[model samples]
Target: MEIMHAVDFRTQLTSIMETLAKTAVVEIGKLFEENSSFLKLEITRCTRENESLQQKCRLLESELQAARKTAGKINRTEASLSHGSTGCICVDICTPTRLDTGNCKLYITNTLHACFPDTAHRPAIDNVFGKDWCLNLWRHEESNAAPNEDTNLSSSGVTVEPVNLLEEEPDMIMIKEEAFEKCSSDKTEEDQNKRLRGAIQKQVKEILPELDLKKLQNVVNHLVYVVGVEKIDDLTFVEVTDLKDFLEPIQCRKLVKTLKQKDFFQESNEQDETPTEITLTPLSSIESIPEQPFFPYCPANSEWLQRFQIPWDRMPPALTQATATGQRARPGARREFVRIVVAAMQAICPNPNLAACREVARWIVSTYPLTFGDITEEGEQLGNGYSCLQRQLKTRVEHVNRDIMEHRIRRPRKGLATKRGADEESYVGKKFRNCKADSYGCVNWQPSSIPEGETPNSLEMKRKVAAEIFQSAGPRAVELTNVDDLMQQTYVYQRHMINSCPPPSISEIELSWPFLFTERGLCRHFKTLTGIDIKSRFGETLNAKAKRILNYFNSQRLRWNEEIQSLLSEIDSDSDGTDNNKTAISAILLMMKYFKEKETSIFISADATSTKMSIEKEMTLPATPRLIMLGNSLLTSSKWFISIEGRVSHSIDSQLDFAAALAVFFGCFYVFNIEYEESAIATLELIQRFFVRINTEGTKCTSKSGTSRKTGSAVQRKSQNFHPRVATFMQRLSEFEWKTSN
Candidate 1:
């Protein structure tokens, strides 16, 4: 039983081993088959890749060969055109093998149409040979045949005239010579020339009526383009007279007789009263006559006078003075003198009227022989003497009045209380009042009262009243008064008071009263009230100090008003109709607070980042979308990871710390917005200006440097780099990149 059990176990173990072996074989075979499949796939991919690479290489080689052939053809075409060889017009030329094809034929047709407009043989040639062969044949035909009458003319069915074709040719030397001789001697030529000359003369005559003599003379004197002076003499008498008429009157008269004497006209000698023929004479004859004198006649005065010879008394004073002084008369003075003289003469004429005083003065200066020496001394003496005479006349009038008053004293009226003249109601009721006062004590006196009568006592009283009035009125009353009032009152104290007030603020003060608060008052107040002499400290004058203060106040007021108005306008314009005044004010306050805090933070951060080149470099990144992502990441990471700490030992120290932080924040904000925007624009402008300057300077330097060794290498390098192909390739690449990006 034990042996049978052991045998069964062995058999089962063998079966198990066999099953394991089979499974291993199946797995190995499957693995092998998968590897084979993968190998085959890879081999096929490699083969296809190699074939594609070979095809690309072949294409590149073919392209290179084509390029070489094109280059050769271009060179050959250029050479042919330059040498003026009649091969193929460059427009028709193509690859040598393609020369026999329809494309080439089409090219030739187009080229022929471009080059020769009247080549009639083009169609026939096109019909006989292909367009390409036609081009070749056309080249041969152009080389062999010169354009002539016999050549194929038009293609549009219109026959070109042989004479017209002949006339188009430039070789007309023989014909020109023959025509010149014929024009010189033939009667027909002479007639034609005469007709032409007559036409020119007639035209000149028509236009000459519109021209001034000077302009006509200029036109006549101008050398003729066709005929020389010798030919001008050959013109007939009538033509010569026409030419003369075109000349200046004087020149015409001079030439007329000479032309007549040249046998160009028949002179008649009959003393008939009525002349049948008009004879034109030489200009010299008329020019030889002496000029006639011009005379001006005055009917009222019954006087006939030569030109520029007016009556001596009709001259102006200044002109007379200038003449006497042997000095050239000024034009203005002469004109004035003439006017004055004419007026004086008219006044003295039969229609006599008193001459104006100014006119009389003008006449005197004009007529008088006042030399420079007399003008220097006698003129001033005369003026002074006249003034004295006037004063004497005035004094005489006053003396006459006194004498009449004294000699014919008012008769004592019946029942008069006192001397009638002294207590007269006529004098008492008179409006004329003297404000003067003497030393005598007046009982009926007041500071505001005006004195009457022209006595020493009255004068003294007036002065005393003025003094009292000023004393009674305090500085404030005087200060508020106008300058005109002070002047009229003759109050010196009042003027002083006004002057002592501070100068008015420019914006706050009325336009009418600018000097209410004068500079002097400000200075005085500074010393009296503040005990600080601003003038001394600032080294400023009273006026300057006042101006400075006014300016400051005006500027402050202007700013305040503008700010207020802007706020008001903003509130009023609000569509919501909310009380935006408070909101605007709050917004402004918030902005200020934010700016202050930001400034402090920015200042601190800037100081911290001073040595941090990485931060600066990062900040310098272009503001593109790509950089925006990175910037956002940096910002978030910085906010999340970075912390700032502040410590202060005292209140003042804390305040300083806060101030510094505020300054830093403001700086950062400013740099991020305003400064960065300005910096970018400035940098771009600087670069552009730099490039412009460089280009301009380089061009100038090259021009000035001339063709020298210093510039040769650089120029050659530039030329090579600027090759058309290279430029085109770069341009295409740029376009491709741009398109791809877009």
Candidate 2:
């Protein structure tokens, strides 16, 4: 009975399975039919939508044709009215000064013009605009003023009869209204651009002072595309295609890149990029510029003039102008031209000696076709106002040759020193300044009991100070703690660095535990001192592991000179063409970065020809930014300039010469035909001499030459074939002092 029941159950299950399979097949078939119908409907909808778009496009085309016709008519009217005048004209509306309200009024003038061929005028009927901003078809209709009438802007506005749109034909008025609206918008854009240019230029001078004007030549296409695509309203700059324009593009990019890096701007979103109202923020407030000279006070122009000797007078005729269509500085205008150029330089510099004159002249001459345009024919060489200007510049530059050849006239300088070699005597040994006690975290700086006026400003009483500092470290020295709290304290400590940072006081707790800080600067400080990265994990938790490694070097308490040298040598070895060298190189760079950022003040000798000047400066403050030039030849061949008789801060604290370091670092990396060790040896030799000079002379070895027998210093040493001119140039750089003022 059990076997029979089992067989029956099996049969029943099989039948049920078969029945369910059949039912599912029918249901799936129905679903397929429904899905096909839905797809058909979607196709129909899309087809209809596409047709509608096509129709709209056709309608817009017809409207565009009509607008173009209207524009053609207005163009004819304008052409007839302005038949005898230049294509462009300006009619300024001056504000009354008699009332003497100091506030300057906006919309001081109204200009009427048509520009940009592709963009037609659009109606702004709903958006009423002022006439001053309107873009109307302006013409001296049937019988008004003659073409030559003087329409100088005055306190009284231009006299004109206003035409009412209501009285004119609808079609004609519509076209005029569109034109007027466009003109208004363009005028506003122009004004915004003017202000933007001023702001941008100011930023360039501040951030990228070493940038040469030539770098700006290739930025037009990139800038225009960015502005047009992004519709960047704040910088709605127009592109100029003139062959004579010398715009500053590299400097512009430098400013923008820096601002972005500093978080002043965020990267533009690729998605959801719609044109929105732009808000431009002014750059961060920089330190006030104290009255100072234009050039570093090296006071050795005879060497400078000879070394930086340029061929200013060899005004090579434009190579493109292959046909020697002789163009000379016009005979009668030559004297006047020279006079104007000299006068302009003298007025601008307050002392147009040959050296000063040369510096300004090189910049002027770089203006290319703008300053010296092509002269195609005989009359082209005639002294027009533009030609006169060019001639004047050339004449001033020519003075360099005369001075160098004759050496008869003494180079005139400010405070003309009656005694010879006064520059050397006046500036020598006078630049030792006391480092402020509160300023901590200085490279190799130890706590000193003596003041600025006292000897031993820089002492290596490290073991004693280390005990005090480590004792204060207390809990921080024991173990890892809250990183956030430590970072805040470190931020406050950095602010105590008076010259580079703000004058902020660090509390006792913060001062006691500075090494516990895990900020960018503290990380750099630890890495520079010891080869270990204390804050590898960017956030809190100052690497407890890395801290152990710092014990070795920190315990020894090496002398300041010994420490700096050991660190540099280690960096040099690690940074030599290896994948793992980035950290080491970065450590070296951080040590010099702050000093490079500080303002460097220079006093240009009143006499351009003679190098006689003094630089009064504080070692903590800088005059100009020093750029690390790793151009096409960072590792192979880099140049070091040599000039004599210049000044640098007499403070020993300013010993890390950024320029010399670059020469050493890149000189090692540079791929020369010589053996790697040979290249490194030469670079190391240069660095050694730099250190020797720094120790003997208070100056960074800039003013006194290694060869200057005037002091108890070693003879100027040379590695291989270091150029004499380059040596001289480097010598002159050591004598400048820093501003002791706020």
Candidate 3:
């Protein structure tokens, strides 16, 4: 029974599966048929709609065409009307009719008769306007006849005249009316002035917000005075009337008085009993009071008053005796005393020379015992020999003081002496190493190893020891292999230390190497070593070279003597020359030739000869002429003459010489060299002189004879020759000539 039940269940499941598959197929077919029918109905509806839209489109297009035609007709009618109104149209017709009739013909015919009343009795309308005009007139008349059809005409039954419609109103008359109305409504001068003042006050309040009304009024009044009434009126947005009324009499008087006080004006004195004519005194004629005297005196009767006035009462007996008779043992004793007092006074007051003499003389006469015999025992002995001298001194002082006060003599100014050789003295001897050693030791003083219980061998040993110790802890210790390496590494390390150390001194490192010592060299080295360049090192380079060159120049006694001799010879030749002017000209010509051969682009210029002047007189060329020539030459050649002289003067500085030499070389190359390949060589050579290290102590070979001659043996022995290609190139350039256009 279980097996039969299983078979029946399997059969029922298979039948159900078959039935579902069949139903699915039928449903799919029915759906396809319904979709197809629906699509057909939609297509039919779309086609009908399209046809209706087409009909509507055609109707709209037809209406647009009719409107365009109507607009074109209207435009033509308007053009014809414009032409007819201009009286340039004519039309011919058998009978006169309002419909499309030429109105221009009638106007022309009427106007022709009006213009010439005495001519032929009547003129044909066509004579005024021909057939073309008549056609235009007809079109205009037609347009005018159909009043409703005219697009430009008004809705009223009457036709709008084109002339009336196109006519523009006169703008000038309208503008005049507007201006008149504005003028009538404008404020009066008085009101405008009031408003201007109010505006000024308001602006002042805004600017100086803290100021009071009274202060603002005062400022405004000042401004008004500074800027005259005419100027104020022009600047301000206000009207002016009776400007004089705005100013007070007192203020006007003050202004006039101030103007009269100026140096250019003549001032009248109102205080004079008789009215004096105002006059101006010449500035040159105005006299000043003289500050010295011609006569002097000492009062004899004022001894008691003089004694009371003196600050010191119980002076030495000698001084008292000298004071008693107003006598002094020394010659010019009073003058010396006056000078000392004057000097002290000058320290207090710059202009006290006159005061010193008067004050001292007055004090001396009034405070001292005056009588020659009025003296104590000690004073008597001193007075006996000095009485007359003292009297003379006092008299002279008195006279000088009086003359100074009375303007009888002029004061002489003291002369000032030049302080040329002023210098500070060092406590140490002159030989005490000019090296600047501050907290840091001298760069020359390197430390060296010394035995524990022994003194260093010398300063050099001590320096070595210090250097070794410094290197051990320095940044380049690993790179320092040998003494040479140590020296090079030490230099870099010391330089860095000097740079990093606070308040570096001048003698932190001894820059003795010629090329390495220079600023350019150091810059090059720094760039090569550290890949960084700096500009401040240029002065260091120049300074290092300057010191070496200066030392060399100063030390060579023979060279100095030779230079002196050469200079003396040149001076003597200049002094003895008969035609100095010709000689100077010759020198200039020679210089020009030399520079030209060298391919230098500099030119020599002299003034055109006007009159035959003496050689001596002509030799002294005017500085202005030379300067003008220099400027012209520079402009023409596009190169400057660095060293310029009048055949007599030498360069003031070494840099000038170097610059002049370099310019000459550069100018030459630019003028001659079509291919500037050798230019770089010359430039490099010149630049090297500024930075290259030269071994000055290197062996120099010279021939025994005064002139050096190349011998066969010498040529054979020559191992190396370093003649720069630039030198050879420049030599060849001497033959080249510059071509100019005709």
User: For model 1, how does the per-residue alpha-carbon lDDT over 1-742 read when each residue is reduced to its tens digit?
Assistant: 9999999999999999999999999989966654453355357546645644565566667768977986786565445334433433334222222234465546656765664444532222223343354456446544544454243333334332221211232133113455467546555543544444333333343433323333333333222321222233333243334543234332343243334343322221132222223222222211111212322222332332112233565566776666644543443564454454444344343222112222223223333323211121101112111121122222333343454555334345565666676768568766753322210111111122222334445444544453454456532333444432432343222222223335222222212222222232323332322223433433322223223222332333444444444544554454544322223222322222212222121111222222234433444422210111111212111111011112110111122222222122212111111111221222212111111110100110011111222333222212110112212322233334434445
Worst 10 residues of 2 by lDDT: 692-701
Among all candidates shown, the one with the greatest TM-score: 2
TM-score of 3: 0.13
Off by over 4 Å in 2: 1-178, 217-408, 411-489, 496-511, 514-523, 526-742
The TM-score of predicted model 2 comes to: 0.29
Instruction: Give residue 150's lDDT in candidate 1 (0 to 100).
Output: 46
Alpha-carbon shift of residue 128 in model 2 (angstroms): 18
lDDT of 1: 0.32
What's the ranking of the predictions by TM-score, best on top?
2, 3, 1
Residue 532 local lDDT, model 3 = 23
lDDT of 3 by residue, 34-71 (tens): 44533553575466456445655666677689779867
The top-ranked prediction according to lDDT is 3
Better of 2 and 3 by TM-score: 2
| lDDT measured at residue 724 in model 2 versus the true structure, 0 to 100 | 28
Q: What lDDT tens digits, residue by residue, belong to model 2 across residues 72-144? A: 9777655544454433232332321221212211121112223212223322233223333222323223123
Query: What TM-score do all the candidates reach, one by one?
Result: 0.12, 0.29, 0.13
